[model samples]
Target: MRNILLLICFALMSSFIQGQEILGDWYGSLQIQGTKLPLVFHIKKQDSSYSTTMDSPKQMAIGLPVAITTVENSQLLLEAPAMGIKYTGEYDHTQEIIAGTFQQGGLKLALNLSRDNFTTAINRPQEPKEPFPYHAEEVRFYNESDDISLAGTLTTPEGLEKFPVVILISGSGPQNRNEEIMGHKPFLLISDFLTRHGIAVLRYDDRGVGKSEGEYATATSKDLSRDTEAAITYLKSRKDLKISKLGLIGHSEGGIIAPMIASKSKDVDFIVLLAGAVLRGKDLLLLQKKLIEEKSGIHDSIVNRSQEVFHGAYELIASNTKTNDALKEDLAAYFKEETNNSINAAQTNSLIESMTSPWMQYFINYDPTTALKEVDIPILALFGKKDVQVPAIENALALEKLENKNIEIFQMENLNHLFQESETGMPNEYSEIEQTMSPKVLNLMLEWILERD
Candidate 1:
């Protein structure tokens, strides 16, 4: 899911030297699935009044006027003096496409927008009908980085210091500090709950995610490790945070990153894993693809073929054998042939990008099981019994194989991928209802971190 705050905030920064009257109904899209949903951008110029209206098919929003930093015929640099996100929009007058990238730091990432009629509807996920147990805050911080200012939110108790601060690292994807999706921000809610319980939380927009500077898709896991390292270092320097008893928590792909951080940093006092994978990423992806196919009702024949292709791709990334240019050309040709007929270019790009990206490449080559042994901290690994995204059975077995004596395992019964309760165990269970991290699981984690302090 594209973090909307980042997209809309940066859309205003374009370096296009627009024509005398470059105002019109503009539209664009952030390729999610295979479809180009409407991202309607309307630029108007009337007398001395210069303004723009932005809309999208996905949600209801009113566009705010942008401060035109610079406008040249084909290229435009626009800035939203209000939000501070700047974009350099390249206009193709003939095709009526304003696309290229939205830049913040040194990274220029892809962004595509156009012009069309926009529809609006609010899809906010249902809030908990049951009383919520936590109070929270979302305060942005300015992280000092080389190319851009990294931004993050610090969630803590209503008013207190010397709390056991935990840095929440995101799993794979360009995730904001909230780890938002389809109207629900899981990490934000998670932070809210944890903080109300007396734990301090530090969660940030993954570099290039929300307000953070960098390219999300191109970032490798190692790069994320550095980002997390920066976060940990930042916490240690703070007078309010009790850095001596710090903890690191990761989920999904984050599960892998937690160990990577703990292996290098002596500052981290404990670690927690929720639905963490303890196997090779290549192997994990295959299982995930198969499970997704099964849940989505994909045909077995097609699933088999996809598995073969993915297996071959994974092997290529991991192989030590040298290859000639001809082989490379052949592989490239095969990839093109396979995707040439996709109906949605963005979905096709998503598949190709997911497979070909640096992080994915690095991820597919390494095994997390190896890292678990080296992670010599007080470790707690938990998995939902019904999780399909990362099978609880596989992860539990891997944890069992861990040589460390300090490891703890909690097998949550009837829980779905997100640790929400679901007995059906069907793949559709995750989306059918709203669920949050169980209070039991949350309490266990807090106790683990606080006890050590």
Candidate 2:
């Protein structure tokens, strides 16, 4: 999965004509899939050169530096080499707009910037507000293994002296305590729901995000598992609250993590997985790419071709036969030949860098079947039938193969990866939908946990 943050393109400093009309802020809405994302380019004049910064208001990210910018002959080009984002457009003086196409990797979308401010009215009604019915406290804990302090919020039902508590583990991306994304705070809502029902919840920022202290970019899933281990250690030390039962509630990548911890840790009493993967990492990613590409309306021919290219690349990486440098060189050559030189060097480099990252390398080889089999605790795994990211049908089949009596797996009909009732279940539709999470999902979790107690 991509980062929960909407915009990845970062600023450009280049020589341009003086006193150009594109000097101020230019607003645009990048429509990907069905969701509309607002983007702003703050162009400024600096002596003989021009500097540009980008703002993604929806994601709360601003003042992002652009890598390259050029304007000449009523045409403008903006490129962020690191992110593989490139925009080439012509400034229409009559319409007072810059008609452009935004390209990143294999995806391309129309993005038109205008002088008028473009804003997407964000409505997330399910987010809990204060005068909350529970007791919430800001807490700090240390991951002794990493020697770093992590910050989070712990919420418990009012007047509960002893209770079962679960640590809320986020997905693949760097997320805050709330798992804030696309104007939605699913973790905040989840904590509120569970706490109101008499279960304590602890949700924290990923390392290097929000108030946490540690580097996230380089940390693999195994490293993140240590952070959760610290939270478990912290909960056990709280003699005042007396947490009776300690369980884990993990979503997406967290699903993979929950099993990793439960298989070895005697401290974990139970675990819940939301949209978890049952297949091997490489297999899951390949399936994810194919499903998403087909749903996005790409022709079968194109999807098949793209899938073949990615499959080859993933195989090379998984082989581990060559040094990192040699592997990168091989990947570069392979990609160039596969695409017939259609992809630019910057895009190829960005793709190679991501596929070769520590996390990607680990994920490509990870198989959670052994971990899942070793877990003796009660396990609850839920999947959205409409989820294209982790398709329920395939995972459910895999679960059937396990036949673990302690595990209970359900495929919720018509739900998406986020457990929201969805039609298409594409990532583009995640921000457009109003529901933070389906009430049915919340109720199911509550009932299951309460029954266990």
Top model by lDDT, which number? 2
Q: Given candidate 1, what's the lDDT at residue 382? A: 88
Candidate 1 lDDT score relative to the true structure:
0.65
CA shift at 43, candidate 2, in angstroms?
11
Residue lDDT tens for model 2, 209-306? 88999998789999999999999999988888878789999999999999999999999999999988889888898898888778767899988997
Worst 10 residues of 2 by lDDT: 3-12
Task: List candidate 2 segments past 4 Å from native.
Answer: 3-27, 31-78, 82-120
Per-model TM-score versus the true fold: 0.67, 0.85
User: What are the per-model numbers of colliding residue pairs?
Assistant: 28, 5
lDDT string, candidate 1, 106-184, tens digits: 3345666665433224233433333435334454444445344567877666555456778888766667787654344
| lDDT, residue 276, candidate 2 | 83
